[model samples]
Target chain A: MSTVSHNEITVTGLSIGYRHKKKEVVIASDLDFKVLKGQLTAIVGRNGIGKSTLLRTLARIQPALSGIIQIKGTPLTAYRNLAWAKITSLVLTEPIASKNLTVFELIALGRQPYTNWIGTLTASDTHKINEVIDRLTLNTIAHRKCFELSDGQLQRVLIARALAQDTQIILLDEPTSHLDLHHKVSILKLLKKIAQETQKTILFTSHEIELAIQLCDKMLLMGSDGFPFGTPRHLTDTGAFDKLFPHESVTFNSETQTFQVRD
Target chain B: MNEKKSYRLPFFLLTLVLVVGFLVNISWGSIHIPFEETLNALLGRPTETDSWQYIIWNYRIPKGLTAILVGAGLALSGLLMQTLFRNPLAGPFVLGISSGASLGTALLIMGASFFSGVLTQGLIGDISITVAASIGSFLVLFVVMTMASKVRDTMALLIIGLMFGSISAAIVSVLSYFSSAERLQRFVFWSFGSVGDLSWPQLTLLLTMILLGSILSILSIKVLNTLLLGEQYAQSMGIDMKKSRFILIVATGLLAGSITAFAGPIAFVGLAVPHLTRQLFNTSDHRILVPAVLLCGAILMLFCDLLAQLPGSAKVLPINAVTSLFGAPVVIWLLVRKQKMVF
Candidate 1:
């Protein structure tokens, strides 16, 4: 256990934003955090806080403006595309237009890094995909096309795809955007269970802050005061969650570790 | 995966259809050749009529093969474009390869017409038309490909392709206005499109290009599958999007370009066969779609050529017209019946 448990991700002095018209726009800067293996972490913030940007930067979809991102003690910049793909994968919020692909075929695509040029999955690739499918309880829908799946079922299948990549890290952007409260809780709970069982360092940007605080082992909070990275209870105790949004709309109550609406 | 075996039945069905279509196509032209005679002539056995053997060997067989090659090549290219662009409406000639070919012949025939008789109808050779069309399509394809790299958005690239095609077509229109009526009619005839009268050397060249394009497509099956998740996901999966886009564009160019060069702008088959194949297979897996599309394209083209032959009638129809006249209704019916068009 001691040999396997370590910091899977370490961000130092990370600044995330985009440049417009030759002007640098920094959404959040000087942010530092570490994600341990086998933990579910969340980056929660209000709208337009660059939560997706931070997640995308970690996923290597975009380059960080000025900072260091380390995955498994190696610099993210140093890892090549193929090597990085084997180490991490993404579950984007954008719906894929290819809704005609069956669940099994879509999930099987996660084996791209491991498969040959023609993508003929080996027995091991098949085993991994099937294992992930089983783990996600998708056997019933494996033969169904993606268009047939409900929002929740599709979310689970998307998670299954990321899991099937067999990477050490998984990054998702808004894994529960369009689902109901029940579906969101179930999806987040499923993510937590997979992290606990597989030792994957799962991190996702989400608007479901309260749910995330309850399910996540760690959280990185983006607020008006500054960025804070810690456990939910610790951040709650430090009043970091209190400054996330305007008090006029909602208030964070530390005693119950919940957000209360204002009159 | 178990899905591997699932496609074999469909493949068998399509192959059966393709074989029947090919035989029916080669047998029932204006001149009647019976089944026994066609089969015997194909097998190189002694036939009752020597003329039947010559017609079967020299005319019908080559024409049938050309139809098959043209169909298979255009369909494969369409699938590539549709997947790459992520557009359901995309077709093989979306890059304006056919239009570029048309412009090339226009420039050759009419570009010299008003200027001088150095390259008049008397002097213009079939080889020259083929070469000119090849160069024209290549030029337009080059511009589209160059834009393909610089532009990040695929939809923008699609628009650029349309625009580039329009620009060249506009150039052709301007060229046509200045030409003599006789040369204009000849150029118009070239645009009508045909799958017959190709010399052996031309057929061999078209075969070579289609074969090369298909091999490239097979090699890209993995990339295509990865791309179904979207380009960002594909890149996250270690696929270099620029390189993948370049490869896809080149393969599409090879197929669409050569077909237009040899067969003229044989339309609709490239655009519609993929949708038809999707409805048939009900999956986007290229492993199945690639082979399935090849067979389906060949079947549809052979049948379209048969219809164009107008069986037992002296008059023939332009293949370009027949493809749409015959294909659009089938595609429309399928899409409307299923109430879903697989993108």
Candidate 2:
């Protein structure tokens, strides 16, 4: 396969898990994968399978147990904290505590890595924020406080915030976990659109494997044995998704790209 | 843009109230200075009588200034605490600075008599209770700051502060139990909180500390605003949480420790003013909230001090009592009316 310069998040001999006391409890080891740029990738696995640990490690919020991970062509650790923040943004599952901030203000916060000392927005910053708001269709309620937003609107605002960060890569942990089917589909579609339009890598972890398979250009299936990274169709064709759960009760239907309980 | 403009009216009204409150506090101390004379005295002009000038310049001016400084410092400290902990109830004393001050004063007034002979014979002459109280508050602040560096969960910090408060309270209780009635009375009076007794030099020190703390807070406006989103999000945005939190705790410690040293644990101003600012401004942008809350705090403190003097009367209420009596009701009303707590 020809190696593309874009989406080259290469992990070699990666070991990720919890570092308790002085010992490291390895959750996944010897992992090798590359997250392609300009693609929406989803990390799907069962609960307690260390999906979050992997995401956190990859985002550089936590340290990897051992190995090398490179962003573009450079080592991930080579980037300074501020420079890393400019290159990538992560949206965690934690809810914002303050409701007093309006949508515009909250989204404008994405410009932190670029703003002045007081976090004041420049004209260019404002232009970028407005563009993201326009892209996300958040203009109607841009002035409304976050407390007044629906979950879907708030999620969109958060995504718009990442966009406003203007990073080359965006990572999210369960961006659509709380949404209904319609919202989930729409959000994933929006991510896909953003990836293609901006040529930025978008990755998220999700339990909605069905929707992910339908929309994600790439899927990172984290399993007990190993991680299998590829397009949904390629993984399905390779029977990788079938081996994901290893249980008789729940079965992966490759034809439909979904899981169904055995009758 | 229109929403930004709307903030001006309340800000204007708060400044007006602050001016009126300052005049009222100066105009009607135990010995009433007529408003005109108070104004003239403030303007550095000769009053109708030299005593009026002496009274205003020596006593009321410093006292009123003390009230403003204490109010602004405590309120600003509380705002930082609440934002830092992401808890609505967190205040300047939430870190046990006031309790530490109480312990210091208690030790001196109650425990001093035990070692009075030796201490008085050597190094402890004319030890101002204010100095002792500040020492105690700073001791506790140092400990809390040390722990703040180690802990990541803000809840742990809150609990640590409460634990410190309990430990100091236990020590104060023991000290009070062993003390004579006169010493106990002095300690009790100190604990009642005072803003009127500071000399110009002490007031100057308090003002300097408060000014430094407020400047630190202003410098941290970005961190403070981002903190409202919670720590994880703030971290993801490239905030150095440990450094920013340390700076915040240090700033709060300075403000709280300084005010507690001078005013004797003046309560509720720190806990209450930020809430009032948020309600009035209806926004949480720290840029607006910081200055607005500081001004509102000054206005409220001056008003409370004026009320404590009991207009046209010789008797004065303990500043602590007045703050709680006025502040608690407003907080309760806000909680009941809003029902949806933002923290």
Q: Give the top-scoring candidate (lDDT).
A: 1
Q: In model 1 chain A, where is the ten-residue run with the lowest total lDDT?
A: A1-10
Off by over 4 Å in 2: A2-4, A246-248, B1-6, B113-116, B120-127, B335-343
What is the per-residue lDDT of model 2 for residues B221-307, given as tens digits with 9 covering 90 to 100? 999888878887777788888999889988998899988988888888999999987877777888888998899888888888888
Q: Largest TM-score belongs to which candidate?
A: 2
Candidate 1: segments with Cα more than 4 A from true spot: A1-5, A19-26, A260-263, B45-54
Candidate 1, A128-209: lDDT as tens digits: 9999988888999999888999999998988898888989899999999999999999999999998999899899999998
Q: How much does each candidate deviate from the true structure in C-alpha RMSD?
A: 2.4, 2.0
Give the Cα-based TM-score of candidate 2 against the true structure: 0.96
lDDT of every predicted structure (CA atoms): 0.89, 0.87
DockQ in order? 0.67, 0.57
Q: Give the Cα error of residue B177 in candidate 1, in Å.
A: 3.7
Lowest-sum lDDT 10-residue window in model 1 chain B: B1-10
Error of 1 at A11 (Å): 1.1
How well does candidate 1 reproduce the true complex, by DockQ?
0.67
